[model samples]
Target: MPPEKKDLRNAGRGARARTPQFVKNFRGVKNWKEASTWLEWRQIEDIECITPDQAGVARGKMMPSKKFTSNTSLALPSAVFMTTITGSYPEDGNGFSYPEDDGDLKLVPDLSTLSVVPWESDPTAQVICDLVHQDGRSVEFTPRNLLRRVVAAYARRGLKPVVAPEIEFYLVRKNPDPDYPLTPPVGRSGRPIGGGQGYSIAGVNEFDELIDDIYHFSEAQGLEIDTLIHEEGAGQLEINLRHGDPVELADQVFLFKRTIREAALKHDTYATFMAKPIQGQPGSAMHIHQSIIDKKTGRNIFSTEDGSESEAFLHFIGGMQKHMPNALVMMAPYVNSYRRLTQAASAPVNTKWGYDNRTTAFRIPRSDPAARRVENRIPSSDANPYLALAGSLACGLIGLINEEKPDAPVGTTANEDRIDLPRGLLEAVERFEGDTTLRDTLGGGFVSTYAAIKKAEFETFMEVISPWEREFLLLNV
Candidate 1:
């Protein structure tokens, strides 16, 4: 639990806070070596004391330019530590990153050529599952099938979900010198390439050519991207995609993340979705705009008469309210991701919702029947989109199936959830184990494997001697 407001206020009274600086000219670098040294800076190596304003700066950024109709922008940074899975530190579950790895990701043979089933099958059915395991597609229990299976369920129920994620990212330019391999890589200091234009203007017009090229590439790849826009962050930008079936949306998000990185490298700049890379600036967020459609009628399920959501929509929100704490770990699966979820400065720290309220974790936009939808505002930029979307879809299904009752919508920015999310990796694992809804919904295999994987991560973190202990507690202890 977060310290009581009084406690947090008192404890922070004498502490100095770190602030991120705004990044202007962001051109990505193809070479990781130039910034490899600083990438392992003192704080990142030893995660202790990494505030929301610090490590949150460099994970990822992706926000599309035209997802919203209003010119208004929210200035809040994402709350970092509150995510259920914010701040990832994988334990080599896949041998892809390491040779001779024993993880299951390597157990199966290459089967990309041998898909277990057509795209329309019950991705979760036992027969397809066996086929996936027989082939390499399900190797290491990759998440593709997890999402495919869920969408299949929705299809059976005469529903199809449309999901689109706001990908927010920064373009970073590097200062490289092979002679000083150990030196920190600096941002573009003095050049036309390093400055930014103001929000929604031709300011970063230098990037127009690059953005156009990206648009073409995305189209070729069958991504759902609909528009692109520059955000308030100096080098920050957003991408919006047309919504589609939830299963398709999840697959696209996975492909989209990898594609962004590859494209940025081709442009010789570093691309990141780190929630908060600079202090005193806005952080990147992955706000998911979602809607459900009746498969048979082709009408929006969340829609009400005259094009607004009815009480059924509120019940869906109720399900999110009931299970958000348990679902957070999957949404922000890394430690650094927690840095974006802090209270104050535009982040939502409470379990609340409102009409078009960007600051709330959940928001409902007023729309006509064709556009009525819900926006899940809790995912951090670094989250695994597959798992995050799955969690949300599952939650909504629960609300409708159980006809859950909901609390009154939260109306304030500062109001905090008393049941704050787990504070550490281990704590999150504990919550996962104890959550009946999640364990039951995601299945025993998923629940068990996920907990085991996360537990291994906690062990890895504990094995290290952190810089904070050396700096402030070594000799004193």
Candidate 2:
């Protein structure tokens, strides 16, 4: 017979933290009352009320569980939206601006996202929050809220968009110095991981302990893992998520990044989502598989009743082809991000799409009619999940509205040195700022604020000189 469940509220008092063998999922709780009950059961001491900032970095306050349950809301400075990834504040003017007073915005906890921090020895729970103005309006510039707005747009049309993200990342040896390059960590065999391990079962087994923890942590948090496989690069792995609502999938991706990093640290290694973490290895990508369903009909809108591809499908592709260039900045948000876009790296250089063609910017995976979808290969793993999904969906929405058709699909490789995307960060920002249609669709305030933040980051990058510059130009000039 199975053991009876304990009345944990009382049984857990002063108990040691739950071991992996007994860890339970707490994501089913839907309100503060429910969250409090779970907290009491777990004897949680701390609660992290976090929200993703512009760079998708976790930002918020952590407080005692007692204080967390007693409070109705929390506040964070509005300037968090204007801050750059380097932790520097950009000056006013140049189309970038922030609240002069830097007033506080309210943080409303997303109870659905409440989950235990599996890595913490002391029992702790973290909840994602949504920011709102003092006037009770949603903060438009925040990454989560921006994605929410795009999802709402789909709802208005009685359609729902679904996305499954295939995120690729690397495990590398701990590098304490910023100047040095990263290398693959030594695996269980006492050897450094080598490249060309694509789909190799032995490659994945190299870090069995860390991978097991990743699975355990994900299960404890109720984050579903569809598949995990070794990719082509040394120490690189790809995790595919089950398909669901766009916003929900984005939330999972947001949490999964933190989860994977925490799991890696437990083994004294680093897991990086950087698009191009190494000089010679292939870059990582967050390939998003997307499709739309009619809310009323309960059918994939991309397919017709007879099972043939519908016009909506072509328009969606058309939308991506027409506007993805302007939207590239959201996917590739950093200077290093552009380094991953080269042809030799197998990253897409143009917006040309194809049927089951890995070289194209968009690839229509072969599937049954109900499961038909397009996979966007542009977004880097380092992209803010919320912004990347919003930018992608926004483009498709515009394409559907305009009723345009995509250019001819390429049978051969599309990365023939024909560069449709911006070559660098500044150029991407310029294109983003100049696109009035996208600006209007994604909210003008968001587009301008995002453009300004990118510009600020770019300027910060210019201040630092690279090793190659000193190596080649020191005596040549």
Candidate 3:
């Protein structure tokens, strides 16, 4: 099971703190509920602290014991307030913004419009306020922040990247089954439920009741659901989000995937974002369609009338090609993710490029003057959107900055290949590690940190023995 779903609700063996006052005040809301309230991206600062005087107002409504010693009391002052900075102060005054399609997930308007009544009136609120005050740096790590930098870079050149992401995944049986192999090995290609052929072409009604809610919920969120087609795998779906700014579209991809998972759970099913949950099945991938528009004039920079004055397009493509290997760690990021990129027909395995080629790494999806663009088919569904968009845009930026020129187009994976992308995650990370120029360009801190973090993950896998090993070797060997 992915650690994301590991129930940390009661991981530790501690009895609920039972103060008579605390119990009375709690009503029945669990501590996790309180914790969840604080999970609001920006809410990690100092909260309302109950004073001696405010006790009367709090006592007026709830319970007696609850008033003297509220359940909110369980939340420590430090726990109530999150410290975003390494030192005594917070990182920023704006507070941490958990980036998503709708910006940070604040139910209320921003602090500029927010009004804080005396927190003493409610213990629960006080805790939440403290949390909000603490996490000032959350905004820095947000997807919004990541995108903002990329968008800003484009503004300098007066170019904006039109980014549309193809989100791929499988809807599977809810919850992880222990009987299934829980080892680190992925892409085993296990069939989820019914014994059905690939892309069974089931009637719309077959999945309508299960899928309609997701589509409608997405509609309510105002997210673009451009295309929703049953993919070439059983119970798998590919959702295409409309193109927007590189960063914003990345945020939308993250949001859409999250919504799909949540909506699927409500229907007593699970949505697997694993690159390739089942072997031989079409692993999910996000093909990023990119085109640069002049920031000032709104002219498509990639457009060409007679394949002349196509310097910017060529430069952009050239940059992506040159830096792709080094920029790959940001794309494929994981060991299991590599398994998704087989010459599997559904996914692009070789790091080749061509004009409108699906089997290659990068494809010029639209060559018309009005709609000229490139589609990066390197990222897996499992990649972190922030890193993915950052790397892709970063490559484009470098390409434009250096006036890089596209070499001979590979045209196909099998043709006399010219362009080469990262072949695997480890291989890509090595390229990233070796490219000091890219590291300097992307900031040494970010590059080193990302490399180190991913290396740790790979090392963790190296330490574990898989169930497959025990199954195949335990007896036979």
Question: How many backbone clashes does every candidate have?
Answer: 61, 0, 21
| Model 2 lDDT per residue over 286-362, tens place | 99999999999999999999999999999999999999999999999999999999864589988988999989999
TM-score against truth, every candidate: 0.66, 0.95, 0.67
Off by over 4 Å in 2: 1-25
lDDT of each: 0.54, 0.90, 0.57
Span of 10 residues, lowest total lDDT, candidate 2? 14-23
Instruction: Give the C-alpha miss distance for residue 40 in model 1, angstroms.
Output: 45
Error of 3 at 225 (Å): 0.7
Scored by Cα lDDT, where does model 1 land? 0.54
Who wins the lDDT comparison? 2
lDDT of 1 by residue, 325-368 (tens): 67777776665556677766455656677877776778877767
130, model 2: CA deviation in Å? Answer: 0.4
Predicted candidate 3 versus true structure: per-residue lDDT over 1-477, tens digit per residue: 464333333334442232123222321124543333322221223333321000011111222322312333222232112211111212222222211332221111111111112212232222211111133442222233445566777787777778888887787665477446312111124323332334444522356765777776565444568877767666677788887777546545655665687777766677877777776566778788888888677778876656444788888888887887788777776777877766545566555567777777788764557678878888888776766887788888898999988777775454233335555556776788788767655655455545555554666667778778989999998
**Any runs in candidate 3 off by more than 4 Å, and if so which?**
1-143, 178-205, 305-309, 412-424, 475-477
